[model samples]
Target: MKSGVFFVAAAAVAWGMGGVVASVLYRISGMGPLAVSFWRAGFGVLVLVLVQLVRRRPVGPRALFPRGWVMIVIGLGLAVYQSAYYLSIAQAGVAVGTVATLGACPILVAIGARLFLGEPLTGRAVLAVGVAIAGLVMIVGGPGEVGPHPVLGIFWALVSAAGYAVVTLLTRRYADRIGSDDVGKTLASFVVATLCLLPLAAAEGLLPASNATVAFGWLVFLGIVPTAMAYTLFFNGLKTVPATTAAMLVLIEPVSALAVAVAVLGERLGLPAVAGTVMLLAAVAAMSVPVRRGSRAAVAAGAAGFDRAAPEPAVAGASEASGDPASAR
Candidate 1:
């Protein structure tokens, strides 16, 4: 494989560590996932800002609020997506929740491609989606996820996953114009999440009840490592690859989560769950399959446009490698 593919794979590995990292923090601080997410965003921004400062790159408005209204609106979806997703994972196990969210994104991408972007739905895309839907049934809505009263937790996660799919599609569409200043977009999303959940976090008493050094340390780690470090690595990985392909690589996250759950949480997946995971993986592969021309040109174009609209130094450095990435899908 080419070196770029290696970067994508590395990204997958980095993203896979997120669940375990978050789980570890939970044990240390006992902070609610929402609070954890909020702190993660807040602290992560500090890291990113410091990096920018050390690089000596001037802070233009783009980095501060790149993409303007469009990014802010997209940020809203992201906030909703993250909030629901974390809640789902907290309520449901990692294996079930991650699959539901990541698995559902392709369908949203396809539908978005056909409608707004005017990309034709090839037979391959259609078939892949159909298989994915069948797989979704078995994994999320199928009899397997059912237990006692119901799996309302997993259901919320499914909704959140669908929402995130839309978020990714929008990012692929708009981030090009926003440029690498896309940090603003991510910040806006996290800010929205924090604000929206402020009331909830307060009500749950998960915000500031902790007084131990362990809790503080975990809070900082949650902010920097999984939330901050993950995204920097995630976007760095994106610079080296295509968005769709990047999305597919993240599928490893669920697998990683499953492994973590089995070893750490002592949870064993049911046979049906495993089968459903296999089907979902197949569906993701089909949906993420590169086009005849390459992976995804439109997505690449959008990323370019976003950079043009709001260029960043790191993104500029990535230009030589990214000018014409083989494919993001």
Candidate 2:
């Protein structure tokens, strides 16, 4: 349990630092959000590929490709999630953008799960959705001076949240069908996302110059540390921790991001925005708490499905655990 907690917390911290790293990359490299996103995904795929090789695992076409159209959908979701998130941060400060996107993830996931995955939506979830939305409104409307084009930033954040929700749902539903390989599904989805973003980055003239060593360094850090390592820790920890517990712990990401924004980047939020942040986080917490007796059972079943479909040898001891939908953010 202690180890599980540590891994989850570590994952959250890594994810939290993602925005800070991206902001620094932007400042130092003058890379657009899409360009940064492209490199992040590109390098992330490389890291996953390396992990596969080190594990002596097969990285054949069968393992890397999704069985059907499900992978394509997941890949698109990944692209949108990454692009929208970075774009939001570029427009809004990291604090507001991270809070807005991560705060709304659980509510959106609940809705997507209910509609598409046949997951039951408890009254608490409905109330959470309402409260979260209200909080989002407060965050978006609180202070016009919060960020440049705050409204647009909020829009991008919401889009990122929605994309994350869809990805979570799809991953839960099709994780079993993707094959019982070691992070094969994850690697494939990232590869697809990288392909999708490459054209956009090129068209925007956002590709990193060959001589931009510093930008490449930052991009490599973003991909290896946040994108790959965070997810690896998260999934490994899921083996010993309950999905609800993991979900709650992952909230540390936004808090960490907020702290970095204020301490490192000197960003500030108004009183209303602070209140909204509290409300949004409260809503997510409320939703994460299992009020129904069947909740644990359902989660267990989902975890079993994932294990049966794709058992990751790298975390074999911790492979029986279920996933937190919002963790995908």
Candidate 3:
């Protein structure tokens, strides 16, 4: 349990730095969001592939392909999530975009699971969603300090949140079939995302020639550290921790991003926005707390039933696994 908590916390801290890093890249390189997304995914795949090679693991087509179309869907979802998230930051400012997207993800995922995955919408989940949405309204409607286009940014951020929710659900459902090799799954999905975004990035052109070196450095940092390493830690932790616990621990990402935005980027929030952020985070925490006794038993029964209906394992792996659906960005 301690190891699980530690790994999750470490992943959160790494992910928390992602926004700040991207913000710096935007300011320094003047690269478009799509361009940044392309490089991040591209370099991330390289990093994962290299790691797998170094570890002497299989990286062949047979090993990398996910069962059926799961990887394709996850790949497309990732492309959308990454692009929209960066665009949200570009339009709304790092602080608001990160908070809105990350803050809303768990609530969206919870609602999605209940509706499609046959998970129950417990009273706790309902309250959490309500409070979270209320908080979102406050953040969106409150004064805008992050960027000039708050509404547009919020829209994109919500899109990112939805994409992330979809990916999370699909990954969890297909995890056993996706194979036991997390690195291979991640690399394959990232490669798909990279290919999907390549054209858009090309249209925008690569990093500015003058800032090429510095920009490339930051892109590599974004890819290797936050994107690759963060997910590695997250997946490792998921081996021991319950998905619920890991989900809650990852809330640290937004808090870390918020701190960096204020301290490093000179961002500020109004009273209402601050209150809204608090409410949103509180809702996430409330929903993540483990239910006790009777409710726990009920949840266990539901899970057991769901497992019975799920397909037999297509590959060998841990039953419960978690990955940062947004590439930890």
Candidate 4:
């Protein structure tokens, strides 16, 4: 459980840095959101395929396109959430975009996990979620310059939230079946996402005019750190953590983003934002606390009833090797 929490938190940190890196790419390269998303996925797939080769895992089309319809959905979800979030940031300011998208995700996740995955919503979990959200609101306070099309930005943010929620729920539901196939799953998703975004990206200009080399370098970073490393850790963590808890942990993304803004970009962190950051961190820490052995067992039993153990040896293998699973793209 501790490891799961650590993995999720670590992934959030990487994702936060990724957002900053994407912003840098946008500034230096003049790449639109679609183009950036495309390159991110495209580069991410290359890295994942390379990793598979290094590990001697199958990189053939058969392995790259496993799991049928669920893989497609996950891939589509990845594309939607990522592109929409970038669009939101473009349309609205980063504060509004990040807050709206990530703030709504945990609520959606909690509701879905309870209804679909049969995960218990304990009082502590509920309180932690509430606190984290309230803190998030405080961090992104006021409606100062919410961009020309605030409504559209907000719409995109909500869409991103929904996409992320679906992915989290689906991933959690099939955690056992996924086993150590994180690389395969992530590679498949990136392959699908890159294909889906290709035309749109091409229309917007796939290559950057200025700082071509630097832009591609950052894009590679976005692929490696955020898309590949972060997703891998997140998927592995999902095997042990509840979807709702995982959702709450993702709040760290914005915090990490804010840190980068302040430190690297010379942005200021106001008193309210600092206090809110503390609250958010505290709430996440509270949520990561393990439940008592009996309570955890009860929750596991309830979840087992909803999720039938598939007749696959990999499922057992995944459970036994809960310490680490092969990663996502």
Top-scoring candidate (TM-score): 4
Candidate 3 vs candidate 4: the TM-score winner is: 4
Name the regions of candidate 4 deviating beyond 4 angstroms. Answer: 89-93, 306-329
Worst-scoring 10-residue span by lDDT in model 1: 314-323
lDDT per residue, candidate 2, 1-329, as tens digits? 46766776788778767756765665677676677778887888899999999988777766677475777777888888777866775577555665577566665676665566555566666676677656654544433235677779879989987876666566555655655552666677777888988988887667654437988988888789877787666555644543434544565565555556667767676566567658767875675455447876765564554445434310000000110111223
Candidate 1 TM-score over all chains jointly: 0.67
What does the lDDT come to for candidate 2? 0.63
Write the residue-wise lDDT of candidate 3 on 19-135 in tens digits.
567656666787766777688888898899899999998777677784748877878887887778767766876556755776667667766666665566688766766776566
User: What lDDT does each candidate get?
Assistant: 0.51, 0.63, 0.65, 0.74
Residue range 182-251, candidate 1, lDDT tens digits: 3444455555555665676666655545445766665566556555555545544444344444455555
**Model 3 TM:** 0.77
Clashing pairs in 2: 180-310
Tens-digit lDDT track of model 4 for 31-59: 87678778888888999989999999997
**TM-score, per-candidate, Cα-based:** 0.67, 0.71, 0.77, 0.88
